[model samples]
Target chain A: MSGKEALLEVDGLKKHFKVNQGWIASLMESFGSGEPDYVHAVDGVSFELREGETLGLAGESGCGKTTTGMSLVKLHEPTAGDIIYDDQRLSEATDAEIKKFRQNAQMIFQDPFESLNPRMTVYDTVAEPLRIHDIPNETARVQRALEFAELLPAEHYFDQYPHELSGGQRQRVAIARALVLDPDFIVADEPVSMLDVSLRAGVLSLLDRMTDEFGLSVVYISHDLSLLRHMCDRLAIMYMGKIVEKGPTDQIIENPQHPYTQALINAVPVPDPGVGRDRVELQGEVGDVIDIPTGCRFKNRCSEYIGDVCDQVVPPLEQKTEFEQDVACHLYESAAGYDPYEEMSGSPSAAETGDGAESTPADD
Target chain B: MSQLEVEDLEVYYETEEGPAQAVDGVSFELEEGENLGIVGESGCGKTTLAKAIIGILPDAGYINNGSINFKGDDLTEMSGPERRRLKWEEISMIAQSAMNSLDPVYTIREQIVEAIETHRPGTGRVESDEIVTEMFELVGLDPERADDYPHQFSGGMRQRAMIAMALALEPSLMLADEPTTALDVIMQDQILKRMGSIQEEINSSMLVITHDVSVVAETCDRVIVMYAGKIAEEGPVEEIFNRPYHPYTIGLKRAFPNIRKSSQDLLSIAGYPPELVDPPQGCRFAARCPMATDKCREEEPEAHYENGLRSYCHYADEIDTELRPYADDSDTWSQTAAATDGGVEE
Candidate 1:
């Protein structure tokens, strides 16, 4: 897909929440000319989602994957930057435009139990989005939504409350509710994390079907890299509110250049008993996001870091290799000059393809 | 001789509907210092079995039938005071959620001290503190953090503290239920590695119950696959993963995704687990089993041992050839897309 086919483009997005340390402390900090504390949730992250392509945003907890997803759909206002949807800048859109944008860009939350209103029946829950969007035929819209969500024969689940359905069924209801407005793009934030392993596949398959049937562009945010690799077409690895690396799913997993990405991949356990892979245990806990250090956000834990270069200058995200691999690490910079693609061409790995190497078809 | 053996264990909870059979006729053994993993889906009676072993089942739950033989002593035959004395002195438990297990009000030191005091009545405060500090170092937690409350610690740290508390009494057996479920990948690895090394140091047997097969593959010596409160397969971890005899075990292994094999599509078991209450008479898994036949519906398969592994299946002998073919063919197991009935029947 070309740039014109891009459904959503997030450019230098940042969401920083002010840390309220009492009125007195706030006043003192303001008067003392000290730096105000802010939780830099999504700090200068940028990516684009092609139409009908499921782009997975993966990171550890508190790494701002959720924050990025929330900001993209306007659940939380961006501190700075722009969200371009269908060639329209959401940041510059009016309230009415934003509302219309919401109708097109829906979200499926993580916890089905908590996300659904207990007081509302499955029918009402699924119909709420339709009602909000003011579809001409409410009943027909609700029925179609339920049908598409695989809550078949709609009447069976129509009268049943959220408490009455199992975890998988409740999630199906959640998906139905999200798809009620026939959204073109959806943000699924850890949708299967809460469900049991047996139930997770069902929900994942459902999402996969929905994406294909609706031709929806999805931002699948999760901590599970393995699951993401299975579902997503392209992936972006996030660390401390930045997209440290982004590329096609197979390329990223087959050969991850970033130290953090490598560590994350190594941590995933192989199912084969004969295959014993080394477990790369990260050195320390993820650092504080409140006052992040300059230069590389992952410098503290990166084993490949080379001293002051990581501490002195913030590395701009430069495209490496002919492949769409973009990385923000000084180590990738050439010694002679700053030929980003030199390191890329030096390696003969399968990941270095500039053009699309269709090794495997999209499985899901 | 087996170090610990549970025979025909039946633990039930008195719910509003009636008695819910949480653990029904479960039997297993663990040798001294051996790591045994009990794998199952949610509500599969694995946790309940762990609780019964540790003598921590709630007041409403009762053991209707079974014999828990630890060493030579029958734990089920012991009196209330005897059982109380046996706890911590012989066996201890680590709950699934560390956040709720640790007392929020007390410091980590105080909690360990309290456990030591209760178990070892004559131990002085200074001696207990020394032991607590030693445990802190053993679990890789900073000794200075002993005085810190549960809230001050991270999730992984809290779990380490719980492990320290369990070790304070120097129990012979440790029952950890999904200890690393809520933790991140790095933390989970650290905690599991610590637990494995600690088990070696103390030379205590462990029973780890978790839903994640990858965890079992990594940390366990022997694994028992449970389904609907019954043992589907039991074998060494390597065998269970490599040459799984039971259909369910094969299905589970196929379903799980691995780092090395990132390209393969993740296979999912089609049907949900059978309900425990009023479960099918013959084989509990017959409903979802691909190789299930009329014989499976009429009579339950008995445990058949072959090559030092046990499996309850009608065609355990055919596992060498037939198992893989059936398991690999995901289409064979896919149930009709009809939505089944919901809610537990009374």
Candidate 2:
């Protein structure tokens, strides 16, 4: 349905925000020439959305996937980067062009319970999009969207407010609002993360069908790997405001090149009891995003850190020989000087917990 | 004797509409040093059950019936002070979120030491410090960061601190309510696995409650499936996962996507669980059950034994082997949902 055309091309995207400084500190900044603090929410990310492809931004919490997803919809304007959609540059577009872009792209927020307006009924919630865009036949378009979103029969829900609807129903209504304008693209941030497991599948299948039928490009952002596997064709693994790896979903999961991606894949709890994975426990918490790391963002928690080069030189996103996915790590780079895994490195204490605890069942 | 036992437990919240029966006639037991898990989704009364056991029910809530026994003593019948005396000394609980559980005003050390001192009164400062350090080591936390405030620690560390506080007294019974729910997957694996090791070291009975099936399957010895304030199935973890007899358990197991498997369409349960307010007199899951017969909607099934497992289904033996295969398809559930709509539609 997409005809393999590039709909949105994002290059070197960066989003940074100034940290709140105390009044005294702000006064001191006038005299002191020290650099003011800034949180690099999204340092640099590059990706392309084919006309109808689903690109999954996968990572743990605070990894900046949400910020990147919100940026495309102009929720968090990028401090530096180029955003070109449908051959039109979005970063420096005219007022009319930006307005048109907003119409074509819409966002489905994370929490269904909080995202919807408490006072608005289903009709008002879905119809608001049409009204804002000044679209004709508001009733017909809203009704069609409600039906397309699988809020079946449509009329019963039109009179009901968000509080009356269940979590699944509320999520469906949110989707309808996004689709009311017949948008060409969607940025869904953890669309089903808040819903129950039973309801998750229903909402996912709805999104899947809508994307396929409408030929819509989607930036589906989620920390859940399983959901991404089911929903997306390609995935970009983020770490501290950077896409450390990006490739086909299957290839990335099957043979993840980056250490962080490998850890994430291994960490996903398998539902079955029979399957056993050699668990990799990260050493400590994620580093403070405010104090971004110099080199690879994941190096502090990385198990197989190469050497001083890992601390000195930042690794570019490079495709290694063994993996089909692109990776940014010194281990894959030959210029890193040496392989640490080949030598003795792991602390006996960390290894003791990693190996001994998994096999030794708690019960006698 | 079992370490912990609950029989005919019923808890109700006094709401404006009426008393919301959150936990209704739920019965289960945990053996000495055994790990048990209560699995359910939102509004299934797992946490209410925990609060009942901990004797921490809110002002508006009360236990209408049944007894919670901790080592032969009826906890429900005990006086307020008697129950308070047993709080961390005999039984301990790791609350849902570690960050919220810890007081932000105090250091982690102060909070832990205070808990230890409150129950066990008057351990010398040096001894208390040593014990705190040992507890930190047991949970893989560095003892040097003991003086750091709650904000200084990570999510996993705060959880570990909470565990250290809970385990400070080495209680015979430990209850962890969604201990790893909010943590990242990597952090969850380590924390849970570390908890298993700690449980083994302490040799304490554990009751873990969570919405994730995998958490129970991997950690607990026995599992109980709950729906609409009633037990759906109860058995050993392996048996329950491999051969689920209850329709609710079958639907739940199939709903979650397997990480190892190829990308296939997920099978979701069609309808939500029944509301507890004036719940109907029938199988709580009958409305959503795929093979729900007319009898299922009319009569509540008792726990019937099948190969040592207990299933609350009239046709447990019949559905055990048959419904397992059909549960993979979403259509099977949707069709039944459509078929049983007109009667007790609420």
Candidate 3:
């Protein structure tokens, strides 16, 4: 699995949206800041999806995980940076190449109810991709896709409209529609978040089995770390449009070095009441992604804030441990020389990690 | 008197076809300052139960039977005006989704102060403002944000403001339905902790209705598992989670992927909850229950009480040795109709 070819490489991806401050508000901000604001949705994100591997992109709301996923599939074009897919640069692709890319890469949205067409029959919905791709034998392909999505028998759902199906069945149709083109890669954004606990396992297992059977590269985006532990082979934690940490799912959960990641894991309620956690409540709201800070985006609420140095320079993602992936916090670097590479061999700066171990009160 | 006692409550909604029995013969008691949780999937009548308790069911909905005894008053027997007077003054409810519940046009201060004015009559705007400010501080919101509208506050903050408004009048019984469902886990934990502290300070009984079993495990002293508009199981939180007696409760426990446990095949219940419109006779869950027999299909079982846990199942006594084994086996429950009906069904 490690030696397998990389199916998708997303390098230095950035997706920023101009804040829609209509007329008067823009005029007011023009008088104050002198420049129109942009929401830094996905700022300088980089990761590769190895063939047949499921990579999870996890973060709180407005953390840009969804934006990052959307950008990769060109739902919203990448504002900057390059996406290389199977020996082809996506942004530079010609019309035919773009068509191939679209056919090859598919996406499953969070809300199946909103994503599926109300008037479209299940057969028509699933067949739309095959017809668009100009694939031969659309009807047979739709049936096969529906079966693969585990909508067993397929015939029963073919004529039914979206409203006639249950939530789980509707989601299966959405999955079937994505699989219709025989996609090489898939971007599933919180695919099972809207599902009930009883039904969620089936959908998860369906996706898991589909990826294995099809050898599909997947980017499974979700905020549920618990679900990610089961679904994803590797995990990347996003904070304010940047990858704060990335590693094996187990390593990240069991030994999360970043303060924000630790807080997230601790905050999730384990199913049993017997297990109590040492909670680290983050101060205030997640800072505005629009007015993202100059230094570490998480530095203001971080328990391991390290004075002027943290406020001055941006921390670079450095591989610290043998098993650990990149960690961007300064706590892993040597303070005296601030040498990240040399400090990687040693333990984290424990004295500094403790100084602000408890959360600081939100100032304003 | 118990803080709140709902005895043999039956609520129904008039649908286009006929009456849909939303809450059927539900009974529960909450002691003073106690916290109770009602856990069920959507349309299981948990929300209807909350609305009935708060006297705010939809126009089509009606409480057909049973007594809602809050303090010394029978809330079900109370007239419309009498119940209106009791609202926010004695029995308040924090509705789900503060974005819609909080008036968009009014500031947090104005909305909460309006609730205060209605209850405390003759209270000046300045005094009400002072009370809201105090509530904002208690809920860890910056006092300055009291002037902000519901749209201005974050989702978590809007929920906090709704809590503040609900608790503004110092109601003895508070009903919060899925208060933290839309929130992220971290925010959910913070809000739950805040609610716990405020509830303690005011010494009010809380009846929280949510589908998240983990939330119930964390917040409630007692738990009720609802299915097909009936209380399937009721017990202390520990007893319910650890030694669940009812098959539905057991299935629910096994259905969710436990983060603490090693990753394995997650247990999935095979069938949808029985449709509430003209629901099945005998045991409503018999269609999905693996341990269910011909006896289960022919006659409904009464609440079998044991070790402070009440299970509406004939085999409640065999939970540990016999029935649990069947519940633990996914093969025992109804599989999705895909195999039987040849495709997915609504």
Candidate 4:
């Protein structure tokens, strides 16, 4: 994927919401001319989504994967930086231009039960997007979308309300609504996490097929790395609203270059009973995002953190492999000397790689 | 004799439509110091079975048939007072969702103290406090935090509090129903390891009911795969993982995401679980099973034993070769659907 093939580009985005102060505090602050405290939900994150390719954004809860997705679709205005869609800067675009952009970009929310209107029927639910986009031949479009979502013979399901449908069927309706416009890009924010184990696979496969069929780019946000490896072509691991590591799915999974990424991989439980790998347990809980650590956000929990360098300054995402893989860790920086990719050639086999892939030094 | 035996257990909910048979004719036994994992999807009656075993099913639900024998005493036949006496003394349970299970108004100490006094009367406050402190330390929680309310603790710590409460009496068997479902990966790992170590320490058996096969694989010694109120397969953890007999077990194993092999895609079982109200004839898993045959649909498969593993599939012998290599598929939709619906079914 090149820039021309990219459907969405989010560059150095930030979203900070001002915390409301008490009345007296507000009055004091107004008189003092002091800056109000802001919740740093998203801070200086960047990524690109290639047309028809699924890019998974993975992190622990409260790490801002959801906020990043919301920011991309303009649900929350960017505090700074630019969002470029199809070569057009979304921040500078006119209302008409933004409306046109909305037709091509849509979102599939985490909770289908909450997202769908209780009062509306399945037919109306799927048709709402088409109506907003002012799509012609509304009924036909709704039926077509339903068919695409694998909810066959739309007539049987059209008049049925959301509560009437099963969890899987309701999710299908949600997907249909998202896809009815034939959008070029989608932000699937934990779409299948709320569903049961059996239903999760059905919804996941549907998303996989729809991506290929509709030529839609997707930014799949989830905490599950194992699920991401199955669906995404590439993935970007986030920590405290920063892209800690980004690469091809195979490379990231087989050769994780960041300590946070390594911890996540190790933390995931393997299904095989015969195979057992030593899990690297991180100390304490995820630190508060309000007052983030100065250097690497993960330095406190990192197993390979050396010393003062990790505490003194932040690490920049440096190219660790030749194949577009980047990681922001101090250990990767010291041994490999900035970009580790220059010394290595072609991608190694998944079997050849091990946990050492993430042990590299960070770039300042 | 087994420490706990559940025979022909049938629990039903009184719905407007009809009686919903949640755990129809489910039978299993747990030996002393053994961990038996009951694995299934949502609404497959794993939780209901757990609740039934502990005599804590909802008011609307009732045991329509079958008996629960704990330490050779018929739990189903026991009187209310008799059951109360036996409740947390011999058998205890760690309920699902510790966040909701713990009372919001009370401190962790108060709740544990109430449970201890209710079960084992005449025990003084000093003795109860000593036991509570020991349990808190056993589950890796600081003893000082016992003063804090449920809301004050994180989800994992609350779960530890629940476990400590359940283990206050040091019961012979523990029934944990999806105890780690709502917890994050790191928390889940700690909670599971604690439960395993605690089981060993107390020399007690446990029945861990969960939907995640990976959790069962890591924590359990023996695994039982259930489908729509019936046992599909039961075997040693290694045997089931390495060589699954039933098609449902195979599908489930493939569906679970493994951290060791990151390249493989999760294999979703193709169809929905059969409605338990009027479950399908023969094997309940036949509708979604890849290896479903005429015989499979007409007559339920009898449990067959081979190489120390037991499976409830008519063609378990023939399906072993087909079931292997399923976990490695990067895209399961095409590969899994292709394998079973092709040669074997014909």
How many clashes in each candidate?
A: 3, 0, 0, 9
- What local lDDT score does residue A83 receive in model 1, on the 0 to 100 scale? 94
Report the C-alpha lDDT of model 4 over B227-281, residue by residue, as the tens digit. Answer: 8888888889999888878777777777766655655656677566777677788
lDDT (10s digit) by residue, model 1, range A1-364: 3233888889888888877688888888879867667887878888888888899999888889999999888898887778998789997888899999999888999999999999999888888877777778888888888887767678777899888887878898999888888888899999988887866766788788876777888899998877898888899998887888888888888888788888888877655556776677677778888877755788888888787556645565667544457877777753335643443445434223211121111111
What TM-score, computed on C-alpha atoms, does each candidate reach? 0.91, 0.93, 0.93, 0.89
- lDDT by residue (tens digit), candidate 3, A1-364: 3346888899878787887878998878878967666788887888888888899999899899999998878888877778998788887889899888888889999999999999899999999887777889988888898888777778877999999988888888999998888888899999988887777877887898877788887899998887888788899999888899988888888888888889888888777878787878788778887776655778888888876556544566667644357787878753234553333334335323322211121111
Residue A296, model 2, lDDT: 62
lDDT, each prediction: 0.81, 0.83, 0.83, 0.80
For model 4 chain A, where is the 10-residue window of minimal lDDT? A355-364
lDDT of 4 by residue, A57-93 (tens): 9988778899999988788888877899878999889
Give the per-residue lDDT digits (tens) of candidate 2, residues B267-326: 777777887888877898877778777999999998989876899999888776666667
Report clash pairs, candidate 3.
none
Residue A256 alpha-carbon offset, candidate 2, angstroms: 1.4
Per-residue CA lDDT of model 3 for B88-177, tens digit only, reads 988888888988898889888888887888778999988888888889888889989999888988899999988898889988889999
TM-score of 1: 0.91
Q: Give a tens-digit lDDT track for model 2, residues A214-309.
A: 998889999888778878888999988888999998888878878899899998887777667878877777787676655567778899987655
Best by DockQ: 3
Model 3 chain A: ten consecutive residues of lowest lDDT: A355-364
